[model samples]
Each structure stands twice: as C-alpha cells, then as structure tokens.
Target: MISRGNRGNALEALVAGLRGTPTDRADWQAVIALANRTLLTPDLFSSLARAGQIHQLPEDVREYLRFVHDCNRER
Candidate 1:
C-alpha cells in the first residue's frame, strides 16, 4: 500500500519505468497502485505493449497488466 507521507511520486515511477530506467519491485508496485487508482492501468499497459517494452517486464507483471487491460476493454 502507498503511504500518505511518501515522498516518491507515483507518476514519476511510472514514467521512469516506461523509460527503461532501472526500477525495483517497490517502484512497480507504486506505479500499479497509482494507475489502478487513477483508472489508467489499461492505458499504461497498452503504452508498454505498443512500445515493445511489455516483453521486458516480468511474467507476473505482464500477466497483471494484460488482465487489467482485458478487463477494461471488455467494459
């Protein structure tokens, strides 16, 4: 869960991750949390996929992103 007093920005984490910057699991967690909160998870996932970066992510993360994107597309 994201702490209220956290100094790290979630959007920054997302952008950094998408930029191919080295990010830890914590950073990806934060980005997913924020994207879910903002209802941007599907879009973010699509961006990664379209950019060919989806294959770079861990299998679990890719699965989660695909699940979220599929859910959104079904709506």
Candidate 2:
C-alpha cells in the first residue's frame, strides 16, 4: 500500500511536472485538480482552469473529481 506521505510527495511531484509539460493542458488541469483537492485548496484548481492557460479537464475522472469538489464546497 502506498503511504500517505508518498501520496503527498507524488502529488507535489505532479504539480512540479506541470511546469515542464505545460503544453498538455488537459493533463495539467487534471493534475491541478488533484493537487488542489489533495492540498485542500479547491479554488486554486478552478482559478487555474478558468485562467484559460490550462484547457478544461477532458477525462471523466477529472471531471468527476471537479464535480465532487464543487458539491462538497456547496454543502
């Protein structure tokens, strides 16, 4: 099983990876969402997504994640 610390480290690494492959907007958006949720800063994901720099997340997984975040925040 993955340790909690490892998961945190992996998410941070993914966030850092964004700076390198910034061309993959979809991936970046997904990564941003993951980072935001994991780090508990949901607005950062939406803010970055709306910024038009990273294209909206296309994958169902990413969309569902955003939906969950939205619903949780609304509650």
User: TM-score for every candidate vs. truth?
Assistant: 0.74, 0.40
State the lDDT of candidate 2 residue by residue for 1-75, as single tens digits. Answer: 445665665466455444432234334444554666566435443554555532434466446546756886898
Name the lDDT of candidate 2. Answer: 0.50
- Please, what are the lDDT tens digits per residue for candidate 1 over residues 1-75? 677644266677676555545245435677788878888788777888877777777788779989999998998
Give residue 28's error in model 2 in angstroms. 9.4
lDDT of each candidate versus the true structure: 0.73, 0.50
Model 1: ten consecutive residues of lowest lDDT? 17-26
Show model 2 residue runs off by greater than 4 Å: 3-9, 13-41, 53-56
Which candidate leads in lDDT? Answer: 1
